[model samples]
Each structure stands twice: as structure tokens, then as C-alpha cells.
Target: MKRLSDHTDVQLTELFTLGDIDAFEEIYNRYWLKLYSAAYKRIKERATAQEIVQDFFTSFWINREQVKIQTSLQGYLFTSIKYLVLNYKRAQAVRNSYAEILLMVNNSFDNSTEENYNYKELLERVETEVNQLPPKCRNVFELSRKQYKTNKEIAQLMGISEKTVENHLTKALRYLRVNLNSLLLLTFLFLRR
Candidate 1:
């Protein structure tokens, strides 16, 4: 009865790479719970933590044949867990977007002064950023924002291909990201203020 914990990480990886299923099982058994605990500590949600750890193992198993262990197994395992935790955090970002979009959607009729102010602030910041775009990007962003034009519609209006219009919009967004941080902070402060 060999103890999985007693085996060197290199030996475990080598054994796994040699198509030994039991050796791979041993590797998984040794690390899965430990990895799960690491994830759980960050997220405090069992389902998300479970999903993260599960994805980590899935990636490792899927690439087991070609998997090269350049670092120690502990390093590789922890690195995978870190990526999974980051992904889990990112997916939850939609919660903020959805809440803002919902406020924008609902404020149309209720006409609360606060909500209306927030909507106007969001629009003003967006407009300011859009105005600062280069000519081509400004034109494309305007068609899409003011006219509610689809990418195809905007492309046709500009006599450019849809791909070109998409590229312009992409660049426009990149520019806004670079330029709009202060405006975004002001807008957020106004909404919360």
C-alpha cells in the first residue's frame, strides 16, 4: 500500500503520463479536496467553488497526455486553481451590469428624480466619450448609439463592410476605456451621491 502523499510530484506526473489510469486517479485523489478547499476559501460559495475545482481537474485530465509539468505539481495545481477563481469572479460581474440595465429600463415611466438623474449622467458620460472618438470611430459610434443602428446598419450607412464597422466600434471602445475613467468615477459618484 503506497501512500499517495509520500510520492514525489514528479513521479506522480510521470506515472500519469505513462497511461497509468490508477496513477492519475491517485493524483486526482491527492489534490482534488485540497484544491476545492483553496477555492472555497476565496468564494465562500460551495457550488461555484465546486465548479471551479471541477473545471481545473477537467482541464488537467483532458491535457494529461500532452501535459508537461515544467514547475512542481503543487505550483501547477495552485496556478490552475487561481485561474478558476478569477473566472468565477468575472462571471459574477454580470450582476452589476444587470442591475444598472434594469434601472435604466425601469426608470422610463416612474420618473423618479434620482433615477432620471442617474440615467442622464450615464448618457452624458457616454456622449462625452463618444464625442472624443476619431472621425471614423465617432461616426460609427454615433450611428449605433443615437440612431440605435445595428452594426450592419451602421456599416451600410458608412458604405463600409460590417467587419470594418465592428473594428471601428472596437477601437472606439478601447479609446473610451483609456479616456473615460475620470468621467466614469464622476458618474458613479453622482449616482451614489
Candidate 2:
């Protein structure tokens, strides 16, 4: 009797596709550690790497029927993990950038009394400017910036298309940029000090 381990990956994959759970188990056992190590090397976070590898396996099983492997299974898994790591890194970068923007906005004024007063005045001006926007544009900008809704979600909520929501946001931003140029310049200079 040939042990499951004696079979090649292609053989095991065929068996797995045929609903042989034992063959799947053997493949999992053979590749799990290697996959984990590959993920760890790229991500450099133990927990995140573990989660990525585990998620890949879960997705692999769930999407097994739809998955068509042209290369070896090992190559396919490695490529999948590589793309996963890249996506994770890209998302992390976006979050980091958002955090930095929030920090800059929040910390624009220091504890100085004059600066604090200026901050209040600036905020009021910004609020007034936002309120002066066209109703749809203001609503879309508020939902996107304050409520943090995606364009698609804003479109659904407003009964408009995503393109319309995008246009509204663009219009609001352009208006604010033109109207509040000096305020933005002051804020930038203040932050630079």
C-alpha cells in the first residue's frame, strides 16, 4: 500500500479534487510550515504571518473548485502569499498616511493662547465654508471626510451614482481650495514652525 506521502503533489491535488480529505490533509501537512515561513519572511510579524498563511489555506479550501493550478501547487501557494503580503503592505501604507494626515490636522495649533484662538477661528471658518457648499456637495464631503463613508456607500445612501458622489467631492474640494487658500497657507506655515 502506498502511503499518501508517497504520492506526488499533482496526484494529491487530483485526489483532493475528487473529495479525498486524506489527500488534502497530507498536502496541508506538507506545505503549512513552508508557507508559514515564506509569509513570515516577507511580513516580519509572527501573528500577521500566521494569520496570512491560515487565511490562505482557508481560502484555498473554500475556493478549491474554482482554482486552476498551471504551475506546481507549491509555486501557486507561494505566489498567492506573495500577493497577499503586498496587499497587506499597501493597506498598511494607506492607513499610515491617513493617520499622519489626521495628526497634522489635529495638531495644527499648539498650547499657545494666540495659536489656540487662531485654531478656533480657523475651524469656524472651515465650518462656514463647508456649510456654504452646495447641499449635495457638502453632504458628500461630510460623509466622505467626517463619516468616512466610501463613494459607493455615499452613492447608495444619497440615491445617486458613485460617479456623481465623486464629482460632488471634487467640486467641494476645488471650491474649498480656491476660497481657503490663505487659511491653508497659514496652517502650513504654522505647522512648519
Candidate 3:
């Protein structure tokens, strides 16, 4: 794994903007394993983590021209992947909670209003973040995260190249990282400083 450096994401984005593919490549090779590890640690699914990294990389390259990262590229990626894993965990928790609630409402006739309400509120907060995504990013994210659609599906649906779909997802996730929670978001955003 390439060692993490103090270099800011803004620098990398500027390099990419100037058509420096090698700079982008260094950023990619440097963080691919680290980011993959972050995702694996959270999701504990090898295939899913690998897919997440692969998707992020593809998206990064696709949007090289327009990609703008404000912090350490590594931190931005880790935070984004963390959000993805949290969203997945949140969805699973809701499903399990709902099942339990149904069983209780059916068997013991007691509704756990507090837990259910809290979970739903958190879920809504996350969903609101997703909804805030730009149109193409939102579409790509929904297709990949919700529909489990492949890049081909997203490309065909959006009538863009698979490469374009990849960029859309990458850029979208970057935006999410900045918006979801401002603590890490702020840390990353100010990474240039």
C-alpha cells in the first residue's frame, strides 16, 4: 500500500484537471488498498469491499477532468466508504428491526414505538443525504446501492458510457462525504490547509 501523505485532495484534483494521469494513478495506487481495507473492515464482505474499491477507482478515472476533491484523497475515500457501509448497516438494521416488531405485534401485541421511531429517524437522515445527490449521481447511486445494478445497467439506463456512469458515482460519493457529517467532512475539506 502506498503510504498516506499530507498532500491535499485539491492538489490531486488539480493535477488530474491538467491531464496528469500519472498523478491520478499515484493517488489511485496509493490509496486503493487502504480504502479497500476500510470498506472491508466495515462490511466484512470480501467481494463487496473489492467491488466498492473497484467502482470508486473506475469512477475516479472517468471523472478525472471534472473531479474535485477538497481534502486528503485518502480521507475523502475512507469517509465516503464509511458512509456507504453505515448506510448498508442502517438498512439491514431496519429490516431486522421491522421483522422483530412485526413478530411482536402479531404475537404479544406490543409495539416498540421508541426504537422503531429512532431507527426510522436516523434512516431518514441518511436518506435525505442520498436525496441531496445531484441527478446523475443519485441515479447511479440508487442503481448500484439499491438495485445492485452493474455498470452496464447504469450505462444503458443513463445512455452514457460505462465510464461516465463510473465518474458520476465517484463524484456523487465525494459530495456525500462532504455533506453527511461535517466533522470528518470539515477535516477533509480543510486538508489543503
For each candidate in the order shown, give its overall lDDT on alpha carbons.
0.72, 0.79, 0.67
On a 0 to 100 scale, what is the lDDT of residue 90 in model 3?
52
Q: Of the candidates shown, which would achieve the greatest lDDT relative to the real structure?
A: 2
Descending-TM-score candidate ranking: 2, 1, 3
Write model 3 residue lDDT over 61-175, tens digit each, in one string: 7876766667666666787778766655654453455345335334432256854554455457657888988877898878876887766677888898765776777676666
CA lDDT for candidate 3: 0.67
**Best by the TM-score measure:** 2
Give the deviation of candidate 1 from the true structure as CA RMSD.
Answer: 10.1
- Using all chains and alpha carbons, the TM-scores for the candidates as numbered come to 0.54, 0.63, 0.45
- 193 Cα displacement, candidate 3 (Å): 69
Candidate 3 vs. true structure, TM-score? 0.45
Q: Which lDDT tens digits does candidate 2 get at residues 35-151? A: 889989987999988988887887788778887889998898899989878766754554455456447667776798978877788778888999999898899989988898866
TM-score between model 2 and native: 0.63
- Model 3 scores worst on lDDT over the 10 consecutive residues at 101-110
Which portions of model 2 show Cα errors greater than 4 Å?
1-3, 112-186, 190-193
